[model samples]
Target: MAVLVPYAAARPKTRLSDFLDSPERVSFSRAMLADVVDAVVDSGGNPTVLATEPVELDADATVEVDDRPLSTAVNDRLAAAADDGDDSTAVVMSDLALATPRVLSRFFDADGDLVVAPGRGGGTNALVVRHPEFRVDYHGTSYLDHLRVARDIGASVREFDSMRLSTDIDEPEDLVEVLLHTDGRARDWLLDAGFTVDVRKGRVGVRRER
Candidate 1:
């Protein structure tokens, strides 16, 4: 199975803009992408980066630039894999900063026509499609939307649950997860930028050290 990682090279992760400036966000996004690619490779899978634009990154993967909407670009690859008589294709989000080889191994080893690892806030973080007719819709509660799509297409769906896969670094608060849990490039980048996890009033948040 080939893994496709969708990366938004141009102005990625706008939700973190309040915490990270434009250039910082870009650099952080690349770091997260590298972590994700490394995890895939370590899990014995080849990853292809479906980037929106040309991106310079130090990772062992093939880069394919497709500026189309996320859903369209991903579905095209799914369709192509189906046409090529491939048994399955996997899609992993680029912002899975905490994902490791062990987490992805379980997701990849799961048996189903449509295996999904849902992200926080009703988004899909990763998925493997064995059924050729299955396509993805990324807009509006895509986790539920994917389940519905699988049901409608008579595809067997299995949900793989893991904290690492569920966490995709997008919002400011998400940085805390990387600080607390990740031991990869993403965490190193945040620490280098003076970002650290702060605990206050029994709540965990991220704060930058001046």
Candidate 2:
């Protein structure tokens, strides 16, 4: 499945998104996007090179999906990715702190025409469509609501336990969440970058202790 992460100067932010000011946090977010991609690539049991790209890189694998607004740009890219409909595709958001290798494995196991990993707030963190045009009518929570759309299109639909998918880092609470679930590179970076990693309140912030 293919993953989609749309970013910009003031990227794809939802009202309840977890965000931070430190560049380290931002950079970690970028790295997290790649780590998640690696996990997805490894999930392929066969010879799939795994279409790879960064949220900030330039390439045909990516389209300017952030320019057209939230879901529109995403759906537009999905529409574009549809050019090659033979591959099972999964579009993942870039903000999920809990996104990990195990989560992706579960997602691959529950593959269907459409599979959505819902975020804490409205909208979704990851969207998986087995093929382009898998669903003709996509609007509203079609990302999360694809279950019904898949049925309408006679396509299979399912939602599995995922490592809470991250979309855009908007709200401060998410920063806290990121620290709790994120580890290794992101965690070390946050500590070194002077961003206090607090999860007691279930949020991440930039107030470093001492």
Indicate which candidate wins on lDDT.
Answer: 1
Error of 2 at 25 (Å): 6.1
Best by TM-score: 1
TM-score, per-candidate, Cα-based: 0.98, 0.66
lDDT of 1 at 193: 96
Error of 2 at 118 (Å): 1.0
Clash statistics: count for each candidate:
0, 9
TM-score of 2: 0.66
**Which residue ranges in model 2 land beyond 4 Å of their true spot?**
9-19, 22-28, 44-66, 80-83, 135-144, 166-170, 197-207
lDDT of 2 by residue, 1-210 (tens): 455654433433343333344454446655555555455555552211122232452222333333455556555656766785546656665555456667666775675777777655555666667756664333355455666566666877676544455433446555555566667455565577566755466433455663
lDDT of 1 by residue, 48-115 (tens): 99999998879999999999999999999999999999999999999999899988988999999999
| Residue 161, candidate 1: C-alpha displacement in angstroms | 1.0
Give the Å error, residue 41, model 1. Answer: 0.2
Error of 2 at 30 (Å): 2.4
Off by over 4 Å in 1: none
